[model samples]
Target: MTPAPSLAELEADCWQQLATALEQKQNRTESHGFQTMTVATCTHLGADARTVVLRQVDADRKYVWFHTDARAEKVIQLEAFPNAVLLLWDPAQQIQLRLTIEPRLHTDDHVADDHWQKLWVGGRKQYLSAHTPGSVQPAPYPGFPPELGENLPSPEESEAGRPNFAVIECRVLAVDYLRLSRAGQTRARFEYEPNERFNWLAP
Candidate 1:
């Protein structure tokens, strides 16, 4: 039988997986492991959960970044309550990671500008929506203008989205990792806030 991985090894492996996911291109299905994560935020009504694309991850700094329209409801929620949770699951690996984060918004700043410049026409197209996210439309809106349809905009044309593009920089306060197996399950927590804490948890 294969021996169980040590806590240290498991921790390293988890970060490696995240790093790999960040480097994967949009065409790579494996990227979904990290590309699509559930983000939970607090609002006046209650807790809101939504799936967001993971744009970047920094294991060393314990930070992650995602983009959104500045007018999105989640953006407002984050502004009111900067604390949020990011949940990522990889079915192939039978691994799950829950991240506690403090998000900072960057819209009309150099940080937003830098990220905007890196986005291709396809990536920028989503920001060109005429209506705010979650708004009621007269008939139906395909998020972006229907005229654009599947066609990618030119580099110059994509610039119109710059004003709507916003980046959320999440400072990871803690990470809870879990892996399942027929033999047994492994769980660990890594905290990096007021004081660093690391330990294995009962599975």
Candidate 2:
């Protein structure tokens, strides 16, 4: 069997996996464990966590982003507390990544436009919601208008949702990587901001 990779090599592997996740998301083919991540944000009451699909990733810049409704509660929380934690687990590989990040919102901007333009009709359907997310309703809501049921909007129709689309871009400051194995577990920390530092940690 091959020997375990050194701390440096492990760090490189972590970044590579992040890049791969984005690629997989684009392909829309094979399933990827890293496709979704739990975003934890601070709220006045306490902490709020939600699962967001991994949207865009820039390994060189150490950033990842996902789309959301502009009216979503999480947007309010992130606006108040820009710092958040991104937790990703790859059940297939038994690896979990925790990233400390600084999030920036992009709406009515070039960044949001780019992502919205690239989004497919089915994905845009959610953005076409007539009501704000998490709003209490007299009856159950299907997110989008009932008329659009089981139907994908035309490209032109999809554009109407642009006003509600918002992108949350997260800049990764530090990464905590953990891998579970039958033999043993490996954990490490990689800090990119303030100063670059890497160290192995006890699992």
Candidate 3:
């Protein structure tokens, strides 16, 4: 029988999985693990959850990044609360990760500019909406200009979205990992702030 992995090993594996997911953009199954995550933020009413695409992952720095419209409700919520949770699930691997993060928003700054330069036209189009996010409309809006449908804008045209593009940098504080398997199950928590804390939890 294979010996169970140590807490440290399990923790390392968790980070490795995230790093792999970030780099494997062509592998849909692996990429989906990092490509989409549910972000939960606090609001006056309570918690708000939304699906967001993962833009970058820095395993060494223990940070994750996502792009959003600066004027979005979630951006406002993060500005007010700053602390949020990112939930990622990989159905193929039967692994789930809950990450606590301190969010820092970058807008109208060099950080945002740098990220904006890396965005392709398809990505830039998301911020090109004439209406702000969550605004009530008399008619349904396609999010972007109707003329741009199914066609990527030129580099110069895509620049129109720069003002609305914002990057949310998440400084990871803790990660709870759960893996389900027929052989057995594994659960662990890795905490980075206050001190490095790592432990295996009962599955």
For each of the candidates, the C-alpha root-mean-square deviation to the true structure, in angstroms, is 1.6, 0.9, 1.6
- Judged by lDDT against the true structure, how good is candidate 3? 0.89
Instruction: Tell me the whole-model lDDT of each prediction, alpha carbons only.
Output: 0.89, 0.92, 0.89
Please tell me which predicted candidate would have the highest lDDT against the true structure. 2
- Which window of 10 residues has the lowest lDDT sum in candidate 2? 24-33
- Candidate 1 lDDT score at position 187: 91
Worst 10 residues of 3 by lDDT: 26-35
Query: How well is each residue in 64-122 modelled by candidate 3, as lDDT tens digits?
Result: 99999988999999999989999999998899999999999999889899889888888
Better of 1 and 2 by TM-score: 2
**Per-residue CA lDDT of candidate 2, range 1-203, in tens?**
99989878998898899888878878877777889999999999999999999998888888899889999999999999889999999999999999999999999899999999889999999989989999999999999988998999999999889999999999999999999999999999999999999999999
Clashing pairs in 1: none
Q: After superposition, how far is residue 101 of candidate 3 from its true place, in Å?
A: 0.3
Score every model by TM-score: 0.94, 0.97, 0.94
Candidate 3: the clashing residue pairs are none
lDDT of 1 by residue, 1-203 (tens): 88877777777787788878877744465554766789999999889999988888788898999999999999999999989999999888889999999999999999999999888899999999989999998898888889999999899989998999999999999889988999788899988897888899998
> What TM-score does model 1 achieve against the real structure?
0.94
Native-to-model Cα distance after best TM-score fit, residue 172 in candidate 3, in Å: 0.3
